[model samples]
Target chain A: MGETIDLKLHVWRQSGPNAPGRFEDYTHYAKAIPTHASFLEFLDIVNERLILAGIEPIAFDHDCREGICGMCGVVINGRPHGPRKATTTCQLHMRHFRNGEEIWVEPWRAKAFPIVKDLIVDRSAFDRIIQAGGYITARVGSAPDANAILIPKQVAEEAMDAAACIGCGACVAACPNGSASLFVAAKLGHFNSLPQGKPELDRRVLGMVTQHEKEGFGGCSNHYLCEAACPKEISVKWIAKMNRDFIRASLRYAPPVERKEGYG
Target chain B: MASSQVLSFTRTAIGQKALVAVTGIILYGFAFFHALGNLQVFLGREAFNQYAEMLQSMPKLVWATRLVLLVALITHVVLVVRLARRAREAKPAHYRFEERMDPSEGILRRYARQTMLLSGLIILAYIVFHLMHLTVGAVPGLFFVRGMAYENLIYGMRTPWVAGFYLFANLLLGLHLYHGCRALFQTLGLRHPQWDRRSFAMALSITAVIVGTNVIIPIAGLTRLVGGELPEDPQEVLRTGEEKHTVSE
Candidate 1:
């Protein structure tokens, strides 16, 4: 004996970013869905029904079908990842919703993220930001012995906290200012705070921030919507750390190769 | 070479924000000291005039300081306007039903964020008007004299509308400074949880101290606590070298 909720969906439909977009209404039948079903699972049932009815399934991006992938995202009822705190769309369950509720679903809307089709959006802008300076340039070799390098436990924890960013673009999607400062800061903090990643710190920050601006992402004014919308609950402190490191790198850094060869 | 690197750094978003933070620090220092200096009025007319004269005596230093402030102000305003425009263009479509992404943020933080641009513009307008009334002696009045800054301040505040506007402007300035400090510390990477535990308190207290002193001067003048009975023509007082006018209070 399971409970089911009949519902209506007003989902945005679009062919591409350049094409016109509109919300198409769909009504779910009185079939009782399992009360324990996840929101995605509910969507899966609706999509199945649509396909069987000779209609195209809603296009959305999801992988791993879990919260970790950071691939699944949609603005449900005018909220990024639905009306939940620190929860991603894939992790959201159907039990959170009331029966006969009309859920409005739309893709993440930003100049940097263009809608592809239905709820899917182009997030390659985030990939470009990562490619700019997201990785440490350390030489690849057999895994170094743990504890070979002594890093302060607190520093390591902070770096790990910053590195938890999944590049979901939720920060960008959720920010009222559409600022990517949080994302850029996360990438910068993950590396700048680490010893192995220290050498190219200045260049990495400069490249990523330049790339972020080029991607048309807005600047952060400490509105902190990203922190609230984050599935990982990444703190705005990392952004502050990034700003500090960026300023230092901008002012004091000289490429290691440019150091004096021999001082007389 | 470092200067050149700094110049190049100023081209990015973080760089622009760092400029705002740095300039904001300078502006904060100026406002804090300016409020402290203006509070000399409560010590009576002689003390305030001596303070004004001391500042005016160092013409070169005063001019240099003014020029630096002008440059910093322009840079802060320009960069902020440009960034605000960029933020506006970032999201063309509006969310129909907006929900609080973070409900934990207090009302002060919300007020600071939403009112930043508006308060900044209002403060800018106030600065220009204030300069006209006192600094430039350009505002047509019987009391605005280039060297008589104390009298100018008192006379300006004697008008209820002017005094009221000053009070309101300083209140907005308090709001701006409160948020500006919080944002600056974050932007400059100066925040540490140990010290940041009191960041809100620090910001609020600093704003209150500065704006509190500033708002007092106009209130004092409007209520006739200082320089209440000065005649329209002060030739007799000037001839007698009684520049230090009597204070009833």
Candidate 2:
């Protein structure tokens, strides 16, 4: 154990997304805190203190503890996933903070993401958007050889860039407009840019964008904040690509004409 | 799913944005030509009147353009209003003080983002006032003779308040067009990573040309830079009459 750091925290408390929420303050004298302890680890220490004091422990959501799961996200002092760029809340180390520092913590603030509890928001809206058209239609069969597809290096890299989106709701939380354009764009770009996904490109874009709007999320106005807040540092260009595909899909495709009985 | 539902576009945010983008392009074209046409004021009353008369002569063309523009204006206004409302609703809670995470964003970009809706509404009001004063001659004493476009324009702008309003409105238009042009390209799918800066540059340039020329006329009128008094040459007046006759014939 390294030298311990004492700190103060102002955490938001809400029973649900639509429920009334308020900030509650707590003080922790971290007697055995490690300098390299992750932020979540620090929180764990606080939760233990509350449990010993016969107080209800703060509720939050976390999975792998590593940055990959995208399960943990919180607004630390008004920024999504804390002050670090391209870093998740779970990965943020306590060394970034100083002893006796006061931090304001809250869950993601957007109509699309309802708060489930203290510092935990329901991000299931992302799942609905993906369900609309995030996947390419492929027949289940034996895996094909990697060399058979032969994708260009540049194209493969671009696809991978979009595929890096961890489906975190940080983009929505960070956007001034509460828009999910970046997330939606990432999914669209990931599939639409790949050769294997080309056949269903138009349908995917149309379905997803439509579902995005139906989800009651805000529209993007090119603020570029989503790119800045994105843990993966996804490019904002994906948004423009999505917008283009949407317009083209809108005009180029129509349902097949129905035939009258015996008319053909 | 119903085929109609599959083909639907405006039901989505992206679809509404594409609609705004296309209509914006149409309006941009009209604005560019309108500013150019008004630039004829510096060429003297004879030339300016001749230009105005030529436009008025083709009633079919004039009416067609007006009809298209009217439809575009209506569609743009309605869709933008709906989208703005939805965006406002999307954020049920707001920060006590909002700050961008990116330090690189400039003040101008922030201004452009925040004032888009305000500038657009101002432009809409300006358009109505403009039509009343210039097009319909409904502004009693503000606008005089209908056939004398050169005098009407100059004399109408002689009022400092009207001239000031024009200058203010033109400034807002410049801001609106600056953002609109770049977003329009993106909405239309013309964006490429290699050409990212080009969109901003192109948008700024186009805004400069349209807004620069448009403002010059009002400033020229207010400051008496073009000419203090309307052209009074008898021969020039006779040429205008002949030009009008030719246009009508």
Tell me the TM-score of chain B in each candidate. 0.87, 0.88
Residues B123-176, model 1: lDDT tens digits: 999999888878887866535666777778887888898999899999899889
What lDDT, from 0 to 1, does candidate 2 have? Answer: 0.83
Model 2 misplacement above 4 A: A1-8, A27-35, A97-102, A139-142, A254-264, B1-7, B140-143, B230-249
lDDT over C-alpha atoms for residue A161 of model 2: 98
lDDT of each: 0.82, 0.83
Per-prediction TM-score, chain A only? 0.93, 0.93
Error of 1 at B146 (Å): 3.2
**CA lDDT, candidate 2, residue A157:** 99
Q: Where does candidate 1 clash, by residue pair? A: A4-A33
TM-score of each: 0.89, 0.88
After aligning candidate 2 to the native by TM-score, how far in Å is the CA of B32 from where it should be? 0.9
Give the native contact fraction of candidate 1: 0.63
Per-residue error for A75 in candidate 2, Å, reads: 1.7
